[model samples]
Target: MVDRGPAPRRGRPPVSDEQRRRQRLAISRHAVRLFSEQGLAATSGEQIARASGVSERTLWRHFPHKESCVEPLLTKTIDAFRTVLHAWPPDVDLAEHLRSAYQPVLNSPSATDVEAVLAVIRLTHDEPALRAAYLVLRERAEDTLAEVLSARTGVPSDALPVRVEAAAMNAALKVATDDLIHETAESGITPDALLRHREHLADAISFVTRRAPGDGRD
Candidate 1:
């Protein structure tokens, strides 16, 4: 037989950034369900990893701790809100823009995904570790909000007025989301359910930004 070089070694394909993100989100979903069903203290890293079909090593590689497992979902929620805010038209009222744009974004997710998000949000209220993770993400969101608002208002992001507006806007959004999730826990997310949520957010956000009707800043 003719001499041949050793066959090229083959191993697992490289994981893309998107693939890593998806894997983290899948693990996060499993972690959220486990935490909701058994309470945070009762849910362990091993349990989350097993439920996600990953080893504890993999879970730890993705998350720093059990509580941090929920960060992906919470981050998704805050990122979506920031995206909507980024798209807010300067010539349009905040409420009006939200009325037109936010509903479709909310409705885009599957019902199961929506419920998972709501459950995670509720978990934060009772779980100190989860609450810390949530608050940290929200604080990061405030920075993003400050940037967007500063651009619109022509003020520096660190300015007192800009910082205050960002904080208030972030608080309003968080409250609106928490209220809607609790209110709709039973009904799930329906058109009417989301309408209430949309209106509450629009009103709260517009009021905080002082961009209500006749403000001209919109």
Candidate 2:
């Protein structure tokens, strides 16, 4: 007769949102490294699970597809930027605020996580699957930016001008991020470089919206 294991323990405690997010990001970091070293096509969910020290079921619970493993890392930067934008003071210059907040945003992701994210982004250039994922994330970022801009400007998110500004800003940010990723991959990114990039992003938004510093005031 086959020996049965002891009765399973009753109801497991629910994972907190923060715990879930961290788990997902951790898995993503492993996935990105694998996808970068081995081609995405060659990397399997089981391999990713093994690399991340999680069960395959747990991996799928966080990411529906392999390509999506990059989402959590990508979301870290997007979420950091969103947090910075949301905290913009009405009376402060956008560029000034961005410069001041830049350090925190850059520091949001660990050095390892940042490198993983950059690797995935670099893969996007050659992998159609990863490119699709990156594009989807960018679209989501645009919507998020529109919402933030609408709140700051007292305009509807769907308003044409607001939408246009958000799109343009996102585009500029994408370029800046791509540049940063490539540059950092080669050498590394300094705090000053990140600050300058933040200033550039703020300037791009200001230029596209034709809004001067402190114009966000009611």
User: What's the distance in Å from true for residue 52, model 1?
Assistant: 1.1
lDDT of each: 0.81, 0.79
What are the clash counts of all predictions, listed in order? Answer: 0, 0
Candidate 1 local lDDT, 60-106, one digit each (tens): 99998998888877777677777787787767777788877774233
lDDT of 2 by residue, 16-46 (tens): 9999988998898888989989999999999
Q: Model 2 off-target regions past 4 Å?
A: 1-9, 103-109, 212-218
For candidate 2, the TM-score is 0.85
Q: What alpha-carbon RMSD in Å does predicted model 2 have with respect to the real structure?
A: 5.3
Give the Cα error of residue 13 in candidate 2, in Å. 2.1
Q: Scored by Cα lDDT, where does model 1 land? A: 0.81
